[model samples]
Target: MASVSRVASRILVPFLVVLGALLWLVLGAVAWAMQPPTTEQLATYLDDASLAARAAEARSYGNHLMRPELLERARFKAENLSRQNQGLAPLDPEVYTPPAAWRGMPTTGTVKVLAVCIAFADKAPVTPVETIRSKLYGAGTGSGFPYESLSAYYERASYGKLHIEGEVLGWYTTSNARSAVTETTAGREELIEEALDHYDALGHDFSQYDNNGDGRIDYILVYWTGEHGAWASFWWGYQTSFWATSYSVDGKRLGDYSWQWELYSWPSGSYTPLVAIHETGHALGLPDYYDYDGNTGPDGGVGGLDMMDANKGDHNAFSKFVLDWLTPAVLSRGRRAVSLAPSGEQPEALILFPQADGQPFGEYFLVQNRWRVQNDTPLPTDGLTVWHVDAQTDGWDYLFDNSYAGHKLLRLMEADGLEEIEAGGGADAGDYYRAGSRFGPDTAPASSGYDGAASGVRIDDISLDTVATTIGFRAEAGPGGLPTAALGLLLDE
Candidate 1:
């Protein structure tokens, strides 16, 4: 009886163990079946993988703009750097201070420009006073170019909020014998002083055009009557303007005072009058978008896409938005689709790319629909133009210049197909987004897409419908993540 009982116990124990194992397996299957894969989960994975791949690519190119480690370091500097004695204009209570010191705060209104056309050469022919004045005010039209074009460019760029008004103080005969090439930085400054003196000699009050009521001229546009080049345009580095003390038609100190002065210029047909517009951008605190060294770093210095970089310049959406000329339609979280009108068309719409995580300015991206127009005639094709702007990287900041890809304020999205075929070596068609192309984290691995995700803005299905004369796109947060408007509003305060 004992043996039979033992046999039964062993068999029962084995059976019970197998039954428990089966039950456990059944429960596992049920759990697995109950929970299906989620869209959020898939998106998260994709975002991660995409970001990882982008990180590797950025590492290969030393792209500090996108690298996580570099970004953290930048954040630390922005927070810890002392603003005291920085010479920065006092921050307005309402102005938004971005994480990067470069962006600072945008201060825009009517740009008051004082035009001084100087005859740099003794033989330099006198360009008509009306011609100079008209060019400045967009009066007469010719190949020499209309000065008003510069103002119109700003006016249209700002949507009329920031108009560039100026008076050509006529042609001032400079006593400086230096040609455009021979003029030293110091000499050019002295020439500027001499030119101002010439204006004074004519008995024109320099104080009349002080539009800002700041007791100083906001900007100076000097058109020297000779071949103009790099030397022709620049912001005077020193704060002490000779004009502050007294004005001398020749060159002498008249008073003991100090003031800040910024100037830009153009040659008389050395390049288009549009060159003035480019230099004027500098006066507005924008930097060159082109690779100054001429090395095509990463994307070819935004490659003839922006006015700051090329002659057939267009006021990129990002630049306009930064200058407070145009406000972008902020695309927020959970927002999917946005319909946009052509920049040339009515009901003009500009879309601001979502901000990056922990970034003060989030490498701002502004989108504007582009088609051939009077000012933007150089567009290779009709399509949507996406502008990548970094306000955190100052025009003067050289440390991050190579890392930031030339420290250009306005970088273009060179997704346009024609860059390779049509525009040729001289032109840049890369930054334009044509119909059916998508740009975002997923597309970053491929060179075909714009590096939009690098700036924390992902764009997709950017299409242009010629029939409707409208452009459409879907924007979402990129890998780095974007701040909510509510959150940003609070932070801004």
Candidate 2:
């Protein structure tokens, strides 16, 4: 009787195992069937032929921001990392070297500005002390040009964390002709000497301008007395500096070096505060966003979307984030919903479609809300703004004949073709969103998507209210989504 019972138990146990396996298979099949068809359709659209082609194009030019040698070294390191993970030995860095760009990085955030007002032959005479206080320092006057306005701009742009500590140090009369203001080293030195002498005579210690007593001035704002014409104002500071001032570091006087500074003519009645704002961006490691051609057009890739691109425009989220103005709430792959308050108030932006290819720097799509407020004087329109970001070490915009010396870090996402950009137009129709605009990777033609990509970030659904001006948009990861962790490294700040 015991032998018979053991035989039945073994047979029943095997039968129960088979039934459980069958039930699991049936449930899995039903769950797969219940998924929305749109999910499958979206997955298909993400991989559509057009999107694949555009992504290839975007990829080819994605490294335009890195110097050739730098990119190659990055590639080698990545390969070595992969090999190590596979239990292989790492490569020697002494044999494979990175470029100078990698060795030395640019400075960003909380730039200290020392401003001087120079009177040249009384034509653009020394700006009135009151006027300088108002316009340059944002001090003491209702109608005065508020330096605070510019400070507020930076503070708001940086989400109230970063801003400039600036003041009009002193006023001086320089007898030199305005044309003598060459951007050359000797010329700038001469002007600086004269301004320093003037301060010395007044018994004002220029050292007070050094807020941190760092022995080196982070930035200098030389406001020459007069406007020569349209071309008189510009930013000219060597990417690297050897010159130093007589300021003491520890016990010795290691002169202050002029690494980054801007020389601009005093703002005539016609000038807007943005001129100072735009040039200061240069001191903080930003490049000109407009086309650099001697002739004019909407030739810049960023066009009017950024302050670096045009005068008095809202800054793009990429620029703001890089400068440590704001940090984005990391977006995950697949589908998700996003609600953006005005960038000035909430300073929130969404990132999507990170680069997946082995390229060192992957492309990123940024979405933020832009509206008119304090310092963003004249935006094209109040709506959502998108940006497609890629960086080039020796990048030249299609508009330039020669490569620019420093980093070219961004590109604007347009809603239409070149027609959407106008030379002096702030932000325009095709470059931004409005109340009824449908946003998606493929919804708008390539003419209207980021970098003219027909398919990339699928904007899926969007709803905007004019009165409230709150923007609610949905975006999903398209094909070739890079590891979210990799993007986080690129934007560690």
Candidate 3:
């Protein structure tokens, strides 16, 4: 009887242990299945952290003029004047495409800028001159928290192809009071001319500032002290009066110039370089990504996810490509699989055309891997960011009052298919594509043309890893597959 009892106990103990283990596994699987999806988790995190709110605050203080269309038209006229001054034939009004240099400042090589610090007679300067200098040209090893200077931002955005080397000289008092200069366009113009004359009297050779010898200086940045005045007093970039009237100093013509407050008080209490970096983008010929309609329109533009939009993060891949700093791999037809390094880290990106023979500058899509690193640290999330671009449309069409009346020149193709951004939502974690996600004709925002025709372009199996994001592409059948031999086509000369 004792031996039988012991054997039964041993058998029952082992069976009970095995049953407990199986029960735990089943409960674990059920709990996992009931939990929210990864996207939901990401959205919750972004909300709890107030990432979107921070972006909104950064955007509240507008960076450019309310009427950017007028600026572009003025720029066109100025470019023609610069060409004629350089003894080059003026760009034909009918020609949409011209030499890259004719677009704006030189896209390649070192660009020498003249930065002048101005103080209003009424308001005192806030940031010191040396601090502004460090913010502009300092290597990442500085006292400032960002450590990334304005020059560093451009160096990274341009993939080292373009360098910003310049001098920051100022604290030069404006003769007029803050209210006087901020009152009108003519007043601001007089202030700029006053500062240039001050430096010119000091024997500063203005001719050396013209880096490209195109009869114009590369750029000039005026850092002014005090709170911005009215909407008219907001920061902006424009060609100096000479751009229209052939204005010159010391035999050098004034070209593109941007004026910004010496410091911004949002997100950071101290002076930061983001606003300066953004205004410089305008100097580089890139337009603002924010909606001019004040979110009253269907879309709020890019929703502050881009540097040119909310003055946050690094420049988007499309901006770099426009400046001739990035060359994307073109996929026009058939099926292909490729991996893209983080665009902020590498100059690599992918371009897809709806039609096999579509022009590179025409309607197309740009895909890039955006990771939250370096200057992109402010971004809410990281994944594959897609942009819908129609270079055929004038950039001024992005303005609300402009009569161009079509799709925006550039639009962020949100992965969540919510069009929340178009509904005036700020950028959130759901805006990007992650692993297992697919974008094609079958998706909510179908890969279609503005005319509502199905575009054969399809992006599938987007997978993100620590190294890079890999994606597969498929195009509708065409006469023949694009030449695989010329896979590396430069977008611009």
Candidate 4:
């Protein structure tokens, strides 16, 4: 009887265990099925994005952690260090401070570029690196703008602060003196790292280089020490500007500045300031003009003079479109608007509207657009187009709009000089924002479709970057009904 009782107890226990396991599984399945994914969380991993205002405050946690650098050269007090010849001198002042509007931020004062002036070299490994200073905030060098004289060009373009010269850090020749086994690439890389250390010691500020003063820096100039073959590039870098934390690592850097260069020219056309300044315009949010406005550019006449056109001589000029976009934002930091219109003959072009984008489209790059006077009343003496105005400001820039991707269709044009901005209709079958004084509230400003506007492969799809604010569409009523006009914007001081 005892054995039988024990057997029954064991059997009952196993059965209970099985039942409990089954019950738990069923309960979990039920709970999961009942709950649904939330909208915000779901959108973070979306395959399709129809409507978006671009993310605001578009910054990463990394920016706060990033650290820029400056060198403090004290006469090479060390006896042994001086023999290596580290006394070439860095860019003048050896430190960079932002303009007053920049709030006393210590920006990346020096960019370390590798100038292979083998001409200056004493021998192998001991390559005499020419530390070419990057042009200051306002140095015109693209095949020389067609000004009557270089002085006239500097006086007009540098905003009269012409003497501000850039720096070339002291040159550091490699030591072929080391066992012949050392690789040139490795040596070059080390020199670059050392140069970075000099700046790192001084502690540079990322925010100061932000010409627009947006919380996030939009542009950076990265000077490289020793790259194998590539010329100093303005576009590619550590993307350090993407995150400030990058600087926490020994080799990390943010390529925030616009102008990049080697100490000298790589090829015949490489050394000119054209590439440096042209790239700077991009850092400031200008687009390629060769492809803008439905015109296959590198256009004739003054068209080629714009940086977007890629002309050696005149290609470095900024377009009016670029000026309107950045003028108020950068200039307004210290100065007040002299007036909307420049002096003489009603000025060439006028900034009708300016708006600040919250973010997601990265501050204002995709948030605004500029319109130029293509044809003034009988055509003003200045051949004014939106691009024309930008050049007058002594800058390099262009325009672009590609919001036709990943959404529905339509946009609105917020006409300037108008008292009321009206949205013709609310969202029904064909409702879009109507005319208003620069994208006022109470109207649907612009929109796109499920698929973006088609450009070739590289540009076929619109990226989810912060540049969308200025690239959307404005839908309004036309002869057919609802019509869309591409959006253009500029910064409002």
The top-ranked prediction according to TM-score is 3
Write one digit per residue (lDDT tens) for candidate 2, span 313-339.
456676666554565654434556667
lDDT of 4 at 391: 12
TM-score of 1: 0.60
Can you list the residue pairs that collide in candidate 3?
A: 242-247
lDDT of 3: 0.59
**lDDT at residue 31 of model 3 (Cα atoms):** 12
Off by over 4 Å in 1: 1-111, 142-148, 174-183, 226-272, 295-299, 344-357, 388-410, 416-431, 444-458, 479-493
lDDT tens per residue, model 3, 58-89: 34433322224323433354344334323457
Per-residue lDDT over 312-374 for candidate 1, one digit per residue giving the tens place of the 0 to 100 score: 446565545445444455543333566666664332544443443344443555667777654
TM-score of each: 0.60, 0.62, 0.73, 0.32
Candidate 2 vs. truth: CA RMSD? Answer: 23.1
Most lDDT-accurate candidate? 3
Supply candidate 1's per-residue lDDT for 80.
25
What is the alpha-carbon lDDT of model 1 when measured against the actual structure? Answer: 0.44
Give the runs in model 2 whose Cα sits over 4 Å from its true position.
Answer: 1-111, 121-126, 139-148, 175-184, 208-214, 227-272, 294-298, 356-360, 392-409, 417-419, 422-427, 439-455, 466-468, 479-493
